[model samples]
Target: MTTPANRWRDTPDRYGLISRLLHWLTAAQVILLFGVLLAWKGFGEHPVTLLLARIGPHGSLGAMLLVTTLLRAIWAYRQRHHRPPRPPGVGGLLARSVHLAFYTLLILIPALAILRQYGRGGHLIFYGMELLPEAEREIAWMMAPADLLHSPLAWLLLALIAGHVAMALAHRLWLKDGILARMLGSPQATRDT
Candidate 1:
């Protein structure tokens, strides 16, 4: 029942409880982050302003997300993932590459988003509490280009997330590969039978 991910038992791909907890927590946070993005864009017109006003400026939120993303990315590369063996062929390699890309985009986009705001002379408020800006307001003049980069890059990350979800569904419904289970469900999910 073990996947290639876990094959190297000596390597510790079987995450400790704390690491697993962090992994799942960050995963949920990332999903919520996307929801926040959706609301921000969708509500850009009228009544949504009320909600966003309450949610507060994105500079702080994006900065917080960027920090969390960096921490998670560091934790991930620092450990191993206990994955199962492939059925064969290029599909396995493709799956692994996609997984890596997900991690990459999550880290990159959040950081870039913050940089975009920073360029606008705004500082991260950290959940509405006033915080000093990392750089001079004068530097926001340079952030304009970052805004241009942040928008299109955001969409690209969205596409990557969609593909990630699609692969999970495909593994669960069609391939019967247990790809989704490896992270969400314990290996014992199959063995319990």
Candidate 2:
């Protein structure tokens, strides 16, 4: 039987509890952030949009996501050797590339926002507590990357997320290869990989 401690660490076949928790939590946050943005764009000044806004302010959610993504990335690196092996050939390469892209955007999107915030001499507030103090003056250079790339990169990240979800569903429903199960199922679950 797997011990309680063992359940918290990755094995060669499946992700551990911490990894799964982080993955799902991050997914939830992303969904909420995007959903709110979409609702605001679609509904204008509707009550539902206001409610969603109250639930998750973009800046606060972005800050939280930045911290979560950093932690998840660190944990993934530590668990890399213990996690399940990837498929061979181009399949593995594609998988790695997509994942790397996800991490890149996940880290960069909020980082750029924070950089822009700092450049504007604004405090970085998360859940009402200030993390970064206001600056003395706006630094145009520091804000330029975000000003130019933030919206476009955010749209790209959303597209990537959609593709990621579709692939996971394909694995679960069509392929029946247990790739999705490796992340969603219990550690004891048997996976082909």
Candidate with the greatest lDDT versus the true structure: 2
Best by TM-score: 2
lDDT of 2 by residue, 72-175 (tens): 99999999888878878998899999999999999999999999999999998887898999999999998999999999999999999889899888877887
Candidate 2 residue pairs in backbone clash? none
What TM-score goes with each of the models? 0.72, 0.93
Scored against the true structure, residue 77 in model 1 reaches a CA lDDT of: 59
In the range 10-106, model 1's lDDT, one tens digit per residue, is 1222344445556676666666666666776787655665465456445555566666667666665565443344446798788678767767766
